[model samples]
Target: MIKITEKSECCGCNACVQRCPKQCISMKEDEQGFLYPFVDTTSCIDCGLCEKVCPILNPFDTKEPLQVLAAKNKNEDQRLKSSSGGTFILLAEHIIKQGGVVFGARFDTNWEVEHCYAETIEELEPLMRSKYVQSKIGNTYKEAEQFLKDGRLVMFVGTSCQIAGLKRFLRKEYDNLLAVDFICHGVPSPGIWRKYLEEIKSSRSEAAGKNTVLSLSLKSVPVITGINFREKQQGGYGWKKYGFVVQAKSPSKGDKNSVLLSSIFNENIFMKGFLANLYLRPSCYKCKAKNGSANSDITIADFWGIQKSHPEFDDDKGVSVVFIHTCKGKGIIKELSSRLDLIDSNLKEATLPNPVYFRSCQEPKKYSLFWNIYKKTKSVHEAVNAATKLTFIDVIKIFLRRFYNKLRRTFKMVN
Candidate 1:
């Protein structure tokens, strides 16, 4: 019963697909590699359930958070492995200890991200850190609903739009369900992610020369064993200057040395393209879940400007900016206080350096240009360079803008 005339009308959350009792709606990928709902008109019974469960059509009202705080896990090793303050792991662990399930995004064997649930603390490892790609929500909503109906405590964490979709699909709220989201900086296309991985494998094979088994056969292609979007082991900047890392093993039967590839956030081709807003879904530019519209109980993100406001808490390791949106969220924070190093903070300071918390990322000027070049060259690196490289005029404009802002700030300080 739902119609998507424009790509921006849908967030590709897969809510409609699961909500349809007739199972008549299927998600089909477009040329841009983003999924859109395709209803089987002949089979659809017009139950109108699909329309009723669309987050975009029935968005929650924007509300201010009840509490804002800076928090980090007390466990240093866990913090190191996490993308931010490692707060999510603690939260997930708490739920698991209570014999509950935690749902989150994790990479599959093929390195594709998907929504999955974990019941044990050990199972929560894959759900840690960030995947950046828009994960396929394959029957996760239905699974979560089943768990909720079974009276099991459940914690669901994902991008805000995903949380919104799940909430919409469920319709009625469950007391035992805890919905958590992040300050999302638009999800990139999974199609582009697959392309980028292929590019990496091909380039690595060429770099290794003739003796490498990677060039032998399609089956001997290197298997990506691990991928870290926010590798915190960078020598100088620690968590603040996280790196992208990919680890792989050649299928040579005997050779076991793993190849490790890494790059800083700015230098990584895929990260560059993602940060520049080159290949994000069209709906990302006009996100319906911005400004607390997802109605999540708790939201978490990197405390980007913690050094300026709480320098003592900024040990160069990651810190989380947490927004408690409801009484349920506050209760959880209290329950976890002993395990977290919590520092009181205000929302204005928390959101100051993290604009994605309130506003969606604008599409880059070279968004179309990047796709055009990629379509022709099939090179992620080339496409990213074409989209992100600044010209002389652009550099000049950046300098002038910075100078103007500095001058205004100085004037206000003097007054």
Candidate 2:
């Protein structure tokens, strides 16, 4: 009975699939590579569980956070590896030390982002950093609930819709569960991601002057080691100017090559398309998971505009704006007080620049045009480039950056 007539009504949280009692619900990927629930008509029980658990249809009540603050991990190494402040790692580590399970998104060997769980400190490293694409939630909520039932502490981190789905799936609150949601700027289609990989592999094979069977079959695509969209490279980690660095494992058997794609966020095709809202899911344009209503125990996001209010905290590395929504969240922060540099801050001021926190993003006017190009060419790069256009000033800034870097190197050599 729970069918998605409109994509905007479904967040694609996969709760219906995992919560089906008859096991008749299956998640089928659409042309855009986003999974939606499909029920077998022959096995129609009409129990209404799916509809009841739908977060969008049956919303829950939530309260404003008790307090908000700006903080960063004292560990420099952790901070550098993180997209923003290392707040996620510190919180995850606390749960792991308490013998808890942590669930979040991570890129697998095939460079696909999916939700997975980790119980050890070592297992949590790959789970860190930001994966821009919408992650496939594959029965992770069921697993997290079981962990909570077993009297084990659980820390689940994801987008707001994801946390809402988990809460609905549990049907009740668990004292040991800590739900953490981030300020999401919408998710790009996984189809675009696959196409991007195909282009990269095809280009690489052509450059090598020979195509292997694996490359031809699209089986041996280069393994993505890491992806950083908010890289702190271009002078500082300011929101206006940031780097997109992607690291890939070498295709050759023993070559340990680190492929770095460092550029301003605007120059990167994927970032440009993403920021332009060219390929976001329809649900994102009218998201129901804003204004602290998702009931997440805690919320963490990049402390954008940190330099203006908290100059001392702005080290160009990263800083996190954290909101403690529940008493449990406050307790956890209190426990990690010594391990972090915390400063009390106004919630309104801290979240001023983050539009996603207050409102949904408007679809770009050229969204259809971009997708039309993608439909015809089947090229992620070509489609995104066609959809988004860089201004003349942006091009000039890019050129000046390259020239400055070259001049700096030359001067160093002369000295």
Candidate 3:
């Protein structure tokens, strides 16, 4: 029987959910909103297929990257919209151009993040920016496998666990498949996210002078009409200054609509809660897929140290640190050589800020207290503030770090 004794053992990959022959296993959400497989005892034949597909139970042999490079797409438009160097767009473009399909996470009409596939250039736009939420993977593994089996090239990009889940679900390797995983900090709780959205709605209604105050419950909020985490309205491509904005239909303002844009770090309650580790999935604190264990063909992330090592590549738009783990990844890079400006770079320097590459995120001592308060208050802001009371020194340290990075960028540009 496939059962999770410890929460940390399950990556929430959904591999077991999709691989069950009798359709006995289903992903059920716990109190924290993280999903785990539940086998229907009556239907389950004790086949152990679910256990076989569990990536955490049967780990893959880790393969070290063949080469590391810093790259950016030549297209200025693509680079600007991308969260990190538009490397993903370039890679996806290659597969699409070859009459193939690309799978990645994208926000749906209601602003909920989920994994889906794109076969055209237009569909790739939504997949450019980082969603920062744990995307629901709905049958994408099976869809990708079907495409590969049909002789169509397939490109899938996601966090390490997701890529590992796909590989495990497929059971066998396919030459037509290319897996690209990113250096992830962690996937935040979807249930917490729903609450956060409700918070936004409640605040917006209050601002709109509504006679009826919407309940501060996840079920009460109207469907989020729009969301933009990387809203550049005020920043003007100032990568350092970003905002998380959400739009909802206005009930009181006569259909004019309402918008909440929080540019300040302190005001962005959802972001603050996420960074404080108040509501991340328990498994994220001890990610089993880190350190290249996912066996992805290529791994990509922001080159955080670009200003110091490769000053020329530090254009403030975005730069990608790419690690090629297999010859197939190397060949893909070669094929896109004309579109990408690659620079041989040191992997150590590139991965300095991304700590998940080496180890999991350390659980804060206040983790339990934070969640307890969150359960009672149902307020993202109050919960985060209660959990992580940023002292004067802590605030100053954060300010100093941002100032130092900006100073370094300025100095590099002047010289």
Candidate 4:
């Protein structure tokens, strides 16, 4: 029987419990709020499905394909309100409408990322946005599998490795199951995210007030809302109901909030989709779902190249990128196409991703100590700060750099 010797090794994704045909495994939480797998010897068929599906045991295949597509996401309103494009929402809508249960991330009362179920398209709003923080999956797969066994359709989505991990656990496939996984980067543990949130809340205020879930808008420097948690019907959030959201900002311009410390990014503090690509679980960085080989049928992400390649696709706000890896994925596309507007750009035309984007989850130790430090980064605010700085020292440095570049160009001309 397989047992969790070190619980920290598990993210509580519950892949192992589902893969066992004998249904021998279950997850339980410990004092530190960590979850580990426990096996039921009575249900043990010993098929080794649990071991086979462990993302640690099997890594993703990272073969790059020549084609990728920039897609016009359906449900435009939700797309504009999404952490990224609302691809997952559209997929979830169809799944739930077909009487399937959708499983994804949500926050508990303490605002920690944890697993939850969305029975309808409406319930998805809270679950759809990217949390950026590492999600705690407590027996979701085991619960989802139970739902599947009773002949209920189910749709599950998460980072590619996670989706793959879920598939490996089930050991078998059913017609009612449709899985979607994202092209992930990595996920950070909740402990690290907790530290960062405390720092933000300390520097800012407890989330309150109209038009603000995080109350980030300072009257002295009113701008876009950041990480609003208020439900939309309550009229505080702009349009969508967001829960457990993370805000990435560009550096500051001389604002009172600006730190004297140097930061990256100009003064733009924008939410650049979900930060799943950042602070990943160690197994996720070395994920085995890189290629199209996982059990997940569909892959989703932002159509990064929509601006250049599919200019006609109308991202006026946002567009979703999609990869249909299997017949099941193709079927989902057909269903979605019927309900929403969609355009196609293969993997290649969408955009040529930077080297880091392709090798996002290659390894964990590959990062330096700086990785932990970078977790504190506020991207949008940093960009704004980078753009607005003109201190006395900066003036001299700019003048020198300009003069040196001019001299070098002149010398090259003469040569």
- Score every model by TM-score: 0.94, 0.87, 0.87, 0.66
The order of the candidates by TM-score, greatest first, is: 1, 3, 2, 4
Q: Residues 311-381, candidate 3, lDDT per residue (tens digit)?
A: 97778777888999989999999998898888998668777866678678888878988889978987766
What is candidate 1's local distance difference test score? 0.88
Task: Write model 4 residue lDDT over 273-386, tens digit each, in one string.
Answer: 123232345555444456664557777766665657756765445566677766777877777776556765665555365222355445323133224333346322232223
lDDT (CA) per prediction: 0.88, 0.83, 0.80, 0.58
Regions of candidate 3 where Cα sits further than 4 Å from its true position: 204-223, 232-234, 248-259, 264-266, 391-415
Clashing pairs in 3: none
Best by lDDT: 1
lDDT of 1 by residue, 1-415 (tens): 9889999889999999998988999999888888899999999999999999999988888999999999999999999999999999999999999999999999998899999999998899999999999999999999999999999999999889999999999999899999999999999998898988887776633224432333434556667888988888743438877677777777764566454466677867788889889999999999999888888999999999999999999987799999999999999999999999999999899998999888889988898899999899877777888888899999999999999999999999999
Q: Model 4: runs farther than 4 Å from truth?
A: 1-12, 17-50, 59-68, 204-278, 314-316, 354-358, 361-415
Residue 339 deviation, candidate 4, in Å?
3.3
lDDT of 2 at 262: 52
lDDT of 3 at 164: 88
Deviation from native of the Cα of residue 121 in model 3, angstroms = 1.6
Supply every candidate's count of residue pairs whose N, Cα or C atoms clash at under 3 angstroms: 0, 0, 0, 48
Which residue pairs clash in candidate 1? none
Model 3 lDDT, residue 85, Cα? 76
